[model samples]
Target chain A: MALTLDQRSASRRESRRPAGPRPVRGGQSPLARRQRRIFGPFLAIPLALYLVLFIGPTLYSIYAAFTNWDGINTPTWRGTDNFTALFDDPLFIESFWNTLLILVVVGIGIFVLAFSFMLLLRDMKGKGFVRGVIFLPHIVSPIVLAIFWGFLLRHDGLLNALIVKFGGEPVAWIGPDSAFLMIMIAMVWISTGFYVAILMAGVDRIPGYFYEDASLAGASAWQKLRHITLPLSWDVIGVAAVLWTISSVKVFEFIYAFGASQGQMPPAYEWNAAVFVYGVTFGGATPQYRFGYACASALVMLLLVTGMVALLRRAMRRDAVQF
Target chain B: MTRTGRLRRSISFAALGLSALLAVSACGSPSGPGDSAASGEFTYWSMWQEKEPQAQVIKAAIDSFTKDTGIKVDVQWHGREVMKKLTPSLRTKAAADLVDQSMNQLGNGLSNTGQSADLTSVYNLEVPGEGKKVSDVIPSKYVDYLKDKEGKPFMVPYEVTGEGLWFNAKQLPTEQPQTWDDLVKLLDAAKAKGVSPLALDADNTGVAKYWPLLTLIRAVGPEGMQKLASDRTGAAWDDPNVLDAVTRVEKLVKGGYFAPGYNSGQYPAQQNLWAQNKAAYILQGSWVTSETKTYAAQGFEYSSVQLPPINGGTDAVGVNFFGFGIPKTAANGEAAGKFIAYFLNKSRLEGISTKADNITPRADIPAPAALESLSKSFQEKAVYPSGAALGLKFGGWESTAFQPVAQSLVQGKTSAADFVSQVKAKSIEFWKTQG
Candidate 1:
């Protein structure tokens, strides 16, 4: 079946030519037309659902923010009064500051720990087992973790018991000054492992040959990380940052469970934005049902987080680094 | 397939989809649980968890009502955290016919907002199979706590409650302290024994802050406490009696009477520590008996003494009855009222004290031996009803203004004078929001 060079060249030339479009597939079969018609309604169902369930309530909350709706009665329009009251209230101010503190402080702490862990774990032995052990807290219910944390820090708790055994005075680890600090630390502990796992996944995707090439070029660990790992994993790190920002603002169970023994609501000083919303609406010995006021506070948090996320995406944007 | 066959199949599918949508939309519509006109059946929301001894007793009484009326009853055990659930549910179609809640909770509940029914008729209704009406058996003081803003009865009183200094009889001095100075002396002596004088959970601002509040009640009569609470001029807080009360709270905080780390400690932890005889005393309500039943140290008998009168002020102890209220939205309001009357019968209410180990609101029903000492002493001790029950101008003023500041005072972050000014300022703000 050996071909002459001229015949082979003729066949290659014919293949290189662009072919004309084939006759329109059976001129659009009736079945195909039916499928196209059905596809729209199926898509519309979910779209309509999303509009009703999510978007509808979100819009309603915006309207409610400017009114005084006690859940049981007609809501009176009170333009900007709720916002004024919320700002004037010391409790709301404390909660706002605490939420921001957790967002920034705990966020930085988690990112640093996770990034470091991901780096160390990249070349470490038994990384799988170590990752699993650390990520265990994310799987456990937060209320359970809060209980164990509260138990460890209480006056006659396990930590104090151990301290007393060594002839040391018990520490007031759960005191008002330290309670929020412990919560922040616990949040960092619970959140870091999940972020690390995400980061490591991103790091693992880079071709081994890139690292080999860098090593041959005499790249140090820090240089390899700075020039190679950081650029490649920027997208995932951005996603993780956004995720942490949203979740850290919504933290309720850990702090709420810390005050479970007190009653329905925690001490006002320990409250954050989420707790504040719940307290104003459904929490505490009496339900204030300040849905309007709570909605105003909620809108503030929503706007803040949304603005931060936008800024973060801008900061993290880079041209895709193709392998 | 044939075109006609495809058309029929598509039509059937469309019909099925339409039917499903109809069913779902119908279910979404709120048809509030039908209120029973003739009382065939009803629902009750009891604010006790399933395992609590109180829940069992409440269930027994409910069962008796069901048997007598032949009306099926559904009970949802919501526990003590029921307020968070009950308040919202009151506005919904699924509102229960009856909800058992604390009388003090009335100050902060749907009852406060006039969402609850006027059960004054229930108070007038005769206890089933009993010769006397509801008012005849229950103490007037308990009934007094049941009044609404307009002086109408909105809730029925059942289980009685009192807050006083609870101490383990075996651990503390046999004789009661006669004055505030003497009380400090006793605390100092207890501290010398390597025991903290008080086991307090400042984190539990509701119950723990009552230590200072009840002292105020003792220093200033209930009238004076009310005057200070309602006064907008800020002069009431400057009253020497009010200063004496704040000083009383300040001394305890600064003196380290409470166990170490108490301001940060969780409740039940401190309460339990007190039960284990780790501290000399704790400020708690009568229900502490049932609350600490599991953690009880063997031979630990609970004894309480009213806070002694200070500066010749009235020697009143804080006492209010805990009971159920029928929401205006109840599906079976009439039946709910009847159930309240039946539940408060002399025979039925005795179980409250016997099985539940709580004080019964009925004067005829004596407290169980565990609380007999306090019950006997309460006859001699003047009762200072909570300001809320007495129609105070504000709801949760104690929780919002008094407690947080009391915490600051205790932590030495604020002095007695500063506490007064801060509270007065808070009161002004709170009053501005009241309307």
Candidate 2:
């Protein structure tokens, strides 16, 4: 019966194809000619725009990285000086370290929390409502979240006020030693929800019969999750990991808005690679306008992220588990 | 034809129409050098927002200039980020004929880049209906202080801002301290009375640097501060005077003189605390008076004193000027110059003091009540433009090297000696990258 149904659907798909002039061997079909005529103009505009707006600047930035361009001034070739100087820059080094810390540390915190929530919600009543609640923070603007986070953690802010009210001494939650940690925590909190949703969608696709069968065979919840759920959701998890790898590197505005004071960038200790680029080029009371140097740092970040994503893809690759 | 096919064709046509509309509209705006000039309209990009008091005063002056000279002016209130926006426009014909910003910003963005026009002619241009030339009414010292790298005047002064120890007269009416020791004594007395001696928004590196920079400027002279900032080897930080300044900062930190959590909270937090009488003093710019006005304690009377002299150091006050400059490529440079001269007229310039609560370069105009003491200091003391300007010349030295070290010292995270060492190390590291 399934074979007959497959053949019927295949015949229907075959019927949907345009009945047009047959292709002259080694030549052309009328449909191909017509498709080219219709879509060629459509494709050309965006392709041209993409080249001009995106690819052109990308290529220019790669070139700019080797020069001493100050945006307005004509660029002069400095060879590898900008790239070499980056290693000597304490700010760039600290920012590079901070960016890596966020990617690995905050990245782990997000995935672990997301997976746990995905499991917890699978059996919970009103799981949709609970999921929606968990996802709320993802929708709010990061700037607004940063402000709210500041008010909660700042000295004499709400949390401190509450502590003082309870006869406890106020603590500097966002002090120099702890500000970056607080930022990382806020990042994890903000990010876990989106990952949970991605993960939940992946978990939802598993057939219920596998869990039922495992249960009848006296399989435990952990066993079912480990054996069935994780394997089924592996591809989605891989995609989510890649998504996070890219997004984490791009985390700028939250830290920028949170740590900033009087329109100046946050202190150097709190900066990530993204903020480092902005600080050197166009940020602060007087912009440094080191376009070439900024581009070099940016290129470094780009290469590192690309290499990391590639490694991640290799690590996550596995044979698909078809049920 | 299939409905879907027909729909797809219509969608493509709509997209094509949209792109055509966008392309046409993009070309419709008047941009390019000489366009406004040929139309006989002067274009100005102001550094003040339209709603700001400074802009209101300038807007009135622009209106009067147009009325008196019959020259139409097109103004865009680009606010504080005007320099960032104006830089790209400099290479294009779209650049404003006139722009205004702090001297340091102009130095970094335009004058240093040779984008500013020499405004010596404008300075000599006579004020409309006033016999005095623009240079005669405004002090030459200001002109000299804000001159371009080539020692040519590029910007005309309108508003003057200076940094000092701000206090509320209603709360602490003590006489101004003359020496660093006396200042410390005053802070101790204020602390003994259960008031936080100082308010520091240490998170704001710009404001946080004030304590160290002021101390350094007072210990060594402005030139000394400039030398340390511009030092490529970073060995200048090892100077005894730099140590003295850092030591004073350490003393303040160890004494617990700063408001609680000063290093943790963002700006305006500690400043607001100072306004509420949670702290007795705050080292800030002249603008602090107006900025904290709304949040001030009832019966608050804003007052300030010049940073006290340290170890018989020169009594030079640090002043920053906000002013106007005509770009080199300006088409309507003559008209812009006339407007600048007209704006300097005492009757028009007084609005900067009266309405804006700021000190104008015109010494004849009485300063606003809050800034009276700062204005007096500027007149009586030997003035040096803020070290911030010199710091910028060294390429990110202020933000990247000095600010972080200063922050560490003020935050009590490092000792004075450690601070100096760290600064020396960071400065050397910073200058290495400048190559």
Candidate 3:
């Protein structure tokens, strides 16, 4: 596979030809400068495409929020009316609180579970199979997962059938006990696989000597995990957490798929920030489309996500412990 | 510089110019989909998929209209994105000539936002063949529907259906309970038999608990309920009749009338139990028969009974119907109006009964075998404008009144009297905000 062309002498000529390593500035090379200037704008193609296609419509929709446009009528300026109403609206508040709670509780729970699994499976048999099995839900579409889950969670769905047979009462997976918990359960179940994979990848990278040396020094398994494994994997943990916070805030499909359980969205156990914005802005029930309020909700979610990632990153701060 | 350097510069300049031009073109067009119907096609959009049987029936209506008018209807069968995808055109008033939507939800959706046109004048249409007026063809079927008190028909009912409770006869019995006592007694019997008395998903909080709450309210007196909704203030979760309803529901829950884990149970299990011989009753509409036909295949015998009152709702259940209306943005209001009148005709409504397994609201239209017997019973006994009329058609009562009341009942939290109070409070609040 080796090409024997220049060896060391040809490289020296090429290096010397670059005008003693200075950039091809306008002073040095007019042609090179012209080429650089001309090619610069052409590189903006991808960004230009992204801005127009995704960001443009999104911005337009955000703008439409300030007005009362019901899909058919001309947008009438409502100013802060949508936001004012959203503040007073009990439903939005309920959803916001519930979503925030789910993010914190479920987020931590799934991470802990995945990390534990990473430790347990390290020296265990069938490690690859176990990892693959756990990650399967992460690979499946959220919509499909939610639909199937509805059957298990709905009042009369599979859960009730089993409960009735087992002399137990059925639980309302969609509605009463807590829609957030239901959503959290599904989210954790679905997301654990992804976190497990990340943790496992991190675990796999740990140097063998660190563990071998620890064992030779008679360091207990628990002490090695706490002192070495935990410290070494903090970088990966931080990255995983950054992913979780970013993803958790924008969650919609899983919650939506778990259907409102008949108006349990936002105001009841089922609602959160995303669902609140959804029902407020482009919902079927609300005659008044509060596009602006929805934008505000989205803005709030973005801030919360940013704040969380920053806080988590800061909290997980430690010097890199290279082996 | 050298000639070769100048030539390389020229080549580079040309390539760079070409790339910039390409990048500029690659920038988003900032325009939506093309107006496919601008090619002289009468575009009709409906909530239909190709595989649906209902699509075929609706297609027949479109086909019939095309045959009679010599117009080509380009119908786009959209399932979901029709609202989001078609929103731009709908807002810009470049919507379809005829759009398919349910009267209540879509009415509140499109027309409530002031998109659709009032069909009052259209109802004053002439008959297609007999030189008779359209009123003569369909009679007063849609006349009352085409206008609000302000004389604006925001949305019109396309299909007619009656709202009531549906139950499996094996558990609920064919002889529909006439009195509220009778209804409770039946539940008691089912409860004693170790079956769920009612198939109520409290979590849904929209229909199940609310129906009984309304039934109890009507029993106490519609006037008081109406006055309470108009009279009360915040959190009227403590009205006497409403309390009674709540107490009764709580009793039902404590007495094991509702399924255990009822809070978390799926809705279908309640009715499914009836199919599986586990449930006794479910509050539903006539559409349940058509909607639950598959139950028959699953060895379940399902039938519907009117929403009986606490003491035989002297007035009746409620009056909600599927409606038809022309969009204010219709390209040809005249043609669209003609289609509405033509299709909702006696023959057409009757034709719908033959095709789609639903009850026709037309007094003259004959019912099919499935609906024939029930239709006779409804005409003979079921009171009019009670069940469907209970909702706020012009005002906003559907979300506030019925759903909340039902949710309370399912949760076993509010009494019937309290439910009524809640309804009253919601009604008043709705009226205050209502335009």
Predicted model with the maximum TM-score:
2
Per-model TM-score on C-alpha atoms: 0.88, 0.91, 0.79
- Compared with the true structure, what per-residue lDDT tens digits does model 1 show for residues B369-404? 667767766566666565333322344455456667
Worst 10 residues of 1 chain A by lDDT: A18-27
Q: What DockQ does every candidate get?
A: 0.24, 0.34, 0.29
Query: Compared with the true structure, what per-residue lDDT tens digits does model 1 show for residues A156-219?
Result: 6899899999999888887877888888999998998899899999999988888899999999
- Docking verdict class for candidate 1: acceptable
Report the number of clashing residue pairs per model. Answer: 0, 1, 63
Of the candidates shown, which would achieve the greatest DockQ relative to the real structure?
2
List candidate 2 stretches off by more than 4 Å.
Answer: A1-32, B1-39
Model 2 Cα lDDT, one tens digit per residue, B1-435: 544676789899989999997885554343323233444578899988999999999999888787877889999999888988988766544368889988777777777766777888888888877899988988887777767767878789899999989998987864878878888888998989999999999888778778888888888888888888878888788778779877888988998898888978877899999999999999998889998999999999988987788878878788899898888767677778878988988999999999999999988999999998889989987888886465457657777777877888888888999988888888887777777
lDDT of 3 by residue, A201-313 (tens): 88889988999999999999899989889898889998998998888877888877665543233223466787766665454423334455567667666767879889998
Clashing pairs in 2: B33-B93
Worst 10 residues of 3 chain B by lDDT: B28-37
lDDT of 3 by residue, B43-88 (tens): 6666657566656777787788788777667778875334444555
Ranking by DockQ: 2, 3, 1
**Top-down lDDT ranking:** 2, 1, 3
